[model samples]
Target: MDSHKILSLLGLALRGNHLAVGEEPVEAAARAKDARLLLLASDAADNTRRRTVHFSEAGQCLWLRLPFTKAELGRAVGRTSAALVAVTDIGLANAVANRLAQLDEDQYGEAAERLALKAKRAAERQSELRAHEKNVRTGKYRPKPRRTPEDSSPQVEKSPPDRRPRNQNRSRPRRGSPTRSPHPYAHSRPVKKGKGSFRKRED
Candidate 1:
C-alpha cells in the first residue's frame, strides 16, 4: 500500500461523498453498518482511538492507523484535526485499505491534501469572521487597520503643474510698424463708382 495511493483514494472518497469524518459521524456510520472501513490518525487522542476502535470492532469493520498525524488528517479532510474517518463505500473502502497496507509515501497525495485544504479554507475564513464579529459585539475586538494601495506601494511626489497660460513661454510679437504685405494690391485704395479716384478714367 502506497501512502499516497491511500491518501489519494481517501481524498477521492471524500470528493465522491463515499467517506465520513469526525468521531460522531464515523461512529454513527459504523453503528448503522454503513461504514466499510475506518481510518484513524496515528496521533489521535487515546480515548478517541479507543472509542473508534471499539466502534469498529462492534461494527465488525476493520480499523487502520493512517500514516499522517491528526493535524494532517484534519487538513486533508478540511477540518482542524480529524481523528477518524470512515469509508462508507465498500469498493473504495477496500481499495483504500489495501493501498494503506502497501504504505509508502508518494506525491499524488500531496495534491489531494492541498486541494482539500483549499476547499476548506473558505469555510474556516467565514468562521473566523463570525468569531471576530462576536468579539466586536463583546467589545473585545480590535480590527487591524486596512492597508490602502497607496500606502502599500511606493509613491513618487510630482511638482504641481504650472498654472500659467500655455503660450506664456513664447514672447508676445512686439506691436511696431506694420509689416509689408506681399500682395500686389497692398497699397490700393478703395474703388468708387462714377469717380476717377483709383478707378478707370472717365471715357
Candidate 2:
C-alpha cells in the first residue's frame, strides 16, 4: 500500500499491545523476525532500507513503510525517532494483517507489491534502531556531564589583618600647671573684721 495508508494501518496496530518499537533498522529487523507485522518510516536510509528488505525476504514477515519522516514516526509512536514497530502477538498480528490487506486492496491494486514495500520499510526501521542503540551503549551518544561538588563549591575569602586595641595606643595627658595641686584655700588664715585688740582672738 502507499506510505500514508500503510502508516494508518500501522498506527491502528500500535494501539494494540503486541508491538515492539525500535529506533534502528537492525533492531526493527530483529523484532520483525518474531513479529507478525513490522512498520517503518519511508525516509529511512538506503542501506537500512535494503537491509529491511533482505530481513523481510529472509524471515517472511509482513512489513510496510509509512510516508512519514523519522521525526513524524517518532511522534506517532511517542518517541524521538522510531524506526520500526513489531506486532508480536499472533491474534494481534492476524488482525493487523487482515486490516492491512483490506487497506492495500482498497488503496492500491497491487496488494503484493505494497506488502513487499511495507516489509522493506519495517526492516529499515529495525536497522536504524539497532544502530542507534549501539551508539548509545558505546557512549557515542554521550550526554552532557553533570556538575560535581567540586565544580559548585563555595569560595572562602581570607580576612584582612586586625588593628591594635584602643588601650594599647593610649598616651598620658599633657602637663600645663602643677600636676598634683592641693585644694585652692588650704593655706589661707581667717581674720576677725571687728576685733578691738591687736592680739588675735584665739579662743
Q: Quick one: best TM-score, which candidate? A: 1
The 10 consecutive residues of candidate 2 with the worst lDDT sum are 106-115
Tens digits of lDDT, candidate 2, 132-200: 999999989977799999779987787987688867665454566445436776677766778555777
RMSD of each: 16.7, 18.0
Minimum summed lDDT over a 10-residue window in model 1 is located at 107-116
Q: What is the lDDT for 17 in model 1?
A: 94
For residues 1-203, could you state the per-residue lDDT of candidate 1 as single tens digits?
Answer: 36556677878889999889988889899999887778888888889889988988877777777779988787777788888999887667656654654453362344234434544674688889999899999999888899999899999999999999868865455578565567979789877766664666598
In candidate 1, stretches whose alpha carbon ends up further than 4 angstroms from where it belongs are: 104-203
Models 1 onward score TM values of: 0.49, 0.39
Instruction: Flag regions of model 2 displaced more than 4 Å.
Output: 1-16, 23-33, 90-203
